[model samples]
Structure formats: structure tokens, C-alpha cells
Target: MSLSKLKLTTCLWFDGNAEEAANFYTSVFPNSKVLHIQRYLKNGQELHRQEPGSVMVVEFELDGHRFVGLNGGPNFKFNEAISFQIDCANQEEVDYYWAKLGEGGDPAKQQCSWVADRFGVSWQVVPTAMKDMLASEDKAAAGRAMEAMMHMKKLDIAELEKAFRG
Candidate 1:
């Protein structure tokens, strides 16, 4: 299969904190950076009604994935239906993301390695081994791992491995 030269980017809708969210995301993830920012101008104020120099959109990269954060007002909000999955290598990595992404968000939304960040974006800080364990040929072991995982918010790699072994 030939890869297309076109670069696909994910757009994150923000009420009025596109730049803040972009900065937070860049800080949390390594190899990430804010690329560009577009501001609202005077001529377009009639439609947007935003301050002339206010942020309109912030283009950023988080761990090599490109994303655009749009300051599209509060007309829309993020829900649990869609979320980004972060593949973590170990318990420490999972903990790091859980704390970083889950901070200042709705605590009630956290469940089974899934969390909503302060900006209302959902993320699943999942351990890479969890996928392999859940896909094991042994039905009983896989079931045990799933059962164990379902009970935890921030995933524990050792506990998951133990469940897989059982």
C-alpha cells in the first residue's frame, strides 16, 4: 500500500483555551511542540466577535501526532464517546499520564484507565501489555485479566500480569 503525502491532523475543539490546551499537551508529552497559532483579526470580528488579537487556532504536535486546537467558543463540548488512547509501556508511564491528563478534570469520569482532562478531552492511558494479555489464546487467563482491569482506574502492570498468569 502506498502512503499518501497528505498530512492528516486531528482538530480539538476548545471553548477559549486552544493555546493553553496546546501548551499543556506539549508539556505533558515528549517530542511535542506548538507549531503555529492563528489569531482573530479585526475584519472577521463581525462573525466571530472575538478580540482582534485573541487566539483562533493553535496547531501543535503531541508525540509526533499533529493536532489543531480551535477556539470555537462554547457551543459544543466533548463527550465520552470519543477519546485518544495512549499506549504506555509500564505502570510508571501509565501513572504519569493518568496524573497529567486527569488533573483538574471531572473525577467521576475516570474508569478503567480512561480519564477526561481539564479541557474535557478523554484519554485512555493503557499499558501496551494489557492488549496482549487480553488477546491471549487462553480464555480463562484473558478473562481474569479483563476482570482485574475492569476494577482499576489507573492500570497496574504487575497486577495485570498476575491476572494473566492466573
Candidate 2:
């Protein structure tokens, strides 16, 4: 399906590596695949400078969300401001995502469960339990969890729960 059909879709800009990025992302997430790839034609080759048959945009689905990766060159780059949060069902799921997504990423950039993949795309591997603790009306418990979270890179669910209960 095309991204236009969705009410909202995220589009990522890449420097001629959209295909590789799409493939990697699909491999990391289950129930995901590259939906369609749009290639540049001769008509805009003059302005775009990309080869006529080169990739222009790669449309893919990660889990259930659709995303378009555009080979728009080096004008822009991904940053820490925006990130996709993965809500894991348990500590095992959180650990799995953390290891897969954090591979070859900048260790210095990792903090509070946020990791920037090798592609420079930031992702937050959050435990599903964290939501309840953080949203709890008991501000002290929420504060404790938040404080505990601030001290860690990959979040420890047990630690957060202990802090919350204290």
C-alpha cells in the first residue's frame, strides 16, 4: 500500500542508502517488509543528479507502521530530537531490541533507553511496564522511576519497579 492512503506516515531522508536502511530495518522488526520502491526516471535526472534507475524512495512497514525512506541526498540528517519508541512486553523483549538496535551505534549517544542505530535513527526501547509507573498519580513513585531511569543506559525494569515501590 502507498503512504498516501494512511492518515499520517513518517518519511525519512537518506543520502542514497534508502534501500539498505529499509532492508536493515525490516530485518530487525518482525512483521515488517519493504512494501514498494520508487525509482527516479530520466525526467528528473538532470535536477536530482541521481541515476535514472537509482532508488528515489523506499516504502516499508516496520511492525505495523509505514515509513518512507527517501534518497534525498546529504542536505539533512537524523538527530536526537525525534525517535521511535518500542514498547516491549517484558525485560527480555527490551533486551532483545536494545541489543539489535544498539549494535554499532554510538555508545555515547545512548541514554535512558534511547539508542541511535547505525543508520543514525534514534529509537527508545522502553519496557511496557514503564508507562504505568511514569503515568501513575502517585508522583513520588513516578519520580523515583524517572530518577532511576536517568541513571541507566538500557533500562532495568526490575530496578525501576523497586524504585517505584519504595
Candidate 3:
């Protein structure tokens, strides 16, 4: 049987730091690298604007996923409507990402999720089993789990499980 896989690539647009952001991401994730780099040419003449050979486009892979970074100028900025969710297995994982990504950014609390990072990207660092526990058949159990999650900035799986079982 042939199965069709849905492959989605996220394209990130930056004012002029697409290359910088790609490098930063590759450093943070394992099995990541800058596959290709391109520079912009204007009428057969390389523009000596800003940094020479500054990243026009960067093709990179992070954790086996492909992403394209476009230095499409600063016409747009990232908003909270679209965010990345990081499913963590434990508090250690949560703390590590929270600290690293939250550098030079503001933190906004939303249950077990927060918005941080210098790029103004929002990340939801949640426990791995949070969704399963939250979707329990028992309404009271699920409610309890949600209640616990709502009070936390970083998800605690142990506490969520406790609430689910109680």
C-alpha cells in the first residue's frame, strides 16, 4: 500500500536576519544544518548594501524538517496567532527551552504555554502526554487536568496525570 504523506515546510520571513535566524535554529536543534545559501544580485551587480553576501535565502534542515528563510525585508512581523508548540517530556526539557528561547523576550502566561524568544516567536512548552490526559473520557477528570494546566506556565505531566486520575 502506498501512503501519501503531507509534507509542510514553514517559510520564515525576516527583515534582514533570515540567515542569522537559520543559524541560530540549527545550533539549537540536533541534525540541523544550512544546506544552501543564496545572495541577491541587482542587474548583474551585487548590491553592497548592509553586509556583503548577506543571506538572501537560506535553506536549512532542523530535526529532519526543512525550512526556508527569506530575507524579504521587514514588511511583516510575527504575531501570536501562529506559534510553535514544543512537547516536552519533563520539567528539565521545559526549563531548558524556556530559558534558551526566552532570552531578551517578554513572557506571556497562557495556561502551560508562553510567548517568548528574541524573534517574538511564541512557543508552547507542554508535556508530552498533556493532550491525551486532557481528552480523557471522564469529564470531571479532564476538567481537573485543564484546571491544573491553566495555573501553570510550563506543563507538569505528573500534576496533570494526578488531576486526571483524581
Every candidate's lDDT? 0.94, 0.94, 0.77
Please write out the lDDT profile of model 1 over residues 1-166, one tens digit for every residue: 9998998999989999999999999999999999999998999787887888999999999988999999989899999999999999888899999999998999999999999999999999999999999988999999999999999988999999998998
Q: Candidate 3's error at 75, in angstroms? A: 0.9
- Compare candidates 2 and 3 on TM-score and give the better one: 2
Indicate the TM-score of model 3.
0.82
- Predicted candidate 3 versus true structure: per-residue lDDT over 18-116, tens digit per residue: 888888878877789999999876543444344545677899998888999888776798877788887777778877777777777676534366756
> Stretches of candidate 1 above 4 Å error?
1-4
Error of 1 at 17 (Å): 0.5
TM-score of each: 0.95, 0.93, 0.82
Query: Model 3: which residue pairs collide?
Result: none
**RMSD, one per candidate, in order:** 1.8, 3.1, 3.5
Report the Cα lDDT for candidate 1.
0.94
lDDT of 3: 0.77
Clashing residue pairs in candidate 1 are none
